[model samples]
Target: MPELLNSRVETCFQQAEAFFNRPFKRAQVSLKLRGQKAGVAHLHENLLRFNPQLYRENREDFLKQTVAHEVAHLVAHQLFGDSIAPHGEEWQLIMRGVYELPPLRCHNYAVKRRSVTRYIYRCPCDGSDFAFSAQRHGLVHQGRRYLCRRCRHTLVFSGETRVE
Candidate 1:
């Protein structure tokens, strides 16, 4: 894990402890490529399965948001048994009171964004342009070829460009 992520996790843990009025035992945190969109939480097993891509991709806001979401789940389970509603009013209150986060909302993890340039492409037909931060977009249906949905044209991958 990155140093920044480690710090965020620690901060989240402290915040959760303060809200719960109890000390939280050490727990494991790891980054995953994809996780269930339901919410972030402490997983007893398969810690790496917890997707950090959300936080890694959107470092600024997501790091805190995801940490808060997972911390809420841990706190809820600790206070109330699993019988309580996963997303009940109590959870919402904890999210705000403990983590100082807004109400829960849907998160779209599939949205692609550009950070540093790993690859560049241009649409052959309409001259549209696209850039990818990662080596691959993970869309392998057509063997690394991406067709422009709008123009229905093949995208030609150009060599990497240095982005500063």
Candidate 2:
């Protein structure tokens, strides 16, 4: 399953390399199937993260659609740079022209959510607007910091602190 996922991802990269006339060396990327997000592209670090659980449960769709979606982000970033909107025209073009897939911004997967303590967190941009997922909250507890994607401000926990 891992090999198959890597192959599909590599194929997308190769196509992008050929189309854009730029190289995305195999060694530069670190692909892993471990994350809460279905798929994420870290353009600065050249990392591609996918959720293995989601992939195993939805193999067909994951390979066909999710794979294309994540790879499109990398291709878009490489071709158009990070200044372009994450899912804007540049990404849509890659989805349609390169991967022959729809430019959908989000996925619909029935990922079960466990009832864990939700810690209230807010960034100045968000203004008392959000709660962290159990996994993310755990990370925060472990001293991992997260910044708001919108305003780039650090998130502050609103609830009382408790040591686990």
> Which has the greatest lDDT?
2
1-164 per-residue lDDT for model 2 (tens digits): 38888888899888878777888644233345454567887777777788878888888888888888888887787777879999999999988988888998887877866445667788887485566777888898899988888888889888743322
User: Pairing residues by index, what is the TM-score of model 2?
Assistant: 0.65
TM-score per candidate: 0.57, 0.65
Look at candidate 1 and tell me the lDDT of residue 66.
64
| Candidate lDDT values, in order | 0.65, 0.78
RMSD of 2: 9.3
Positional deviation of 22 in candidate 1, in angstroms? 1.0
Report the C-alpha lDDT of model 1 over 46-148, residue by residue, as the tens digit: 1322455566666776666766676666666667766777678777888888888885756655655444655567787777668765555445334877789
lDDT of predicted model 1: 0.65
Candidate 2 at 15: error in angstroms? 1.5
lDDT of 2: 0.78
* All models, RMSD in angstroms: 8.2, 9.3
